[model samples]
Target: MSSYRIIGLFALLGGLTACERPTPPLAAGQEPAYDLTSYLQEQTARLQQEQPPVLKSVITKGQPTETLQLEELDWEKELAIFQEVDLSRPALRDFYREERHTLPNGSTVSIFTKDAEAAAPVDRLQLTVSPLQKLERLEAVVLEENLLFYSKRNISLTAEPGSGNLNGYRVEGVQKLIFGDSLRYRVDANL
Candidate 1:
């Protein structure tokens, strides 16, 4: 192997082993302010370090952003008030999300996740809840009529608004989508 490759390998290994970050000390008698940004930065460094240095992404990157928080609305009770929707009509609908998962049994399972979108019958604020596993490209339409976007993640893909849309999305945790440009968008599906 070349000297550079050997050095790179060692560097990767060192980063991997040294990543158990100590918790930050709190100030005496003063409550520490919550800092989501710092927490996410720390998390990214650890994940990168822990994964084997191979062809980049053979290891799962997990959910986009680890952040992208969902908006809350009292939709279920309101959806119950719908006159047209049959109780049997599943206020929330599930579609297929095909993904590969590393099963507990040391196997990668190719499966489809149930992506469900639900709404309150009366209040009309819609919510899309996707399985944490294999959840991607979320969107919603009410009565197959009105459409709205509460939140989205991953911007690695292309985002074209007016002229360009959103591409890839990344989430750091339950608190944020790493890239948020809420102007307008059309995305390329080729990715």
Candidate 2:
């Protein structure tokens, strides 16, 4: 009987010892390190070192008979939007996941998709770069779910204009919008 009681006490002590222990607190002046930001900046620099991509053509299909195409694009003004995108910010970085690919032309394309729950107006964004990582082609599309803003306002993806500093790509999109019956007007930029 006494041996049995001793065994139970030992088991209880062993169980308590096996419980999880808290991590040791950091010492003064010691900071936990996370280098995701530095890695992203390095990748950006490597891509930018190459000649920037030139937009050959941009075509917008579908909508109220306004099929717009831009053959001659002002690289500076057109790309200005991309240059302003700041990915280093914690919120924006957490919101998008970037995937990069190398094309046969020796160029690279990087696509950033917004996380499901947090993604708004802009759902998908893409950038094509030269072999050396220069900007080549840029495209962004906002899904229909994000378009319906107001209860009475029905927005069209192909007919709405939007702008944003998408990661490193600045984009300016223009589309039209229709507000109820007998109230149709062009809406440019919803970014």
**Candidate 1 residue lDDT tens string, 1-191:** 69999999999999987995545443465322222223224433443444322111111234232222223323222122222211112222223233444445343333323445533322122111123322122222222223432332222212222222122322211112245433323222221
lDDT of 2: 0.44
Off by over 4 Å in 2: 1-88, 143-191
lDDT of 1 at 87: 19
Candidate 1 RMSD to the correct structure: 24.4
CA RMSD of each candidate after superposition: 24.4, 15.2
List model 2 lDDT by residue over 1-191, tens digit each.
Answer: 99999999999999998894645444575322223234334434543553334323222334353323333334344333333332434445556667777677776566768898874544666655455433444556544432433212222211111221122322234434444333233323221
Candidate 2 least-lDDT 10 residues: 156-165
lDDT of 1 at 42: 43
Best by TM-score: 2
lDDT, candidate 1, at 89: 25
- The models' CA-based lDDT, in order, is 0.30, 0.44
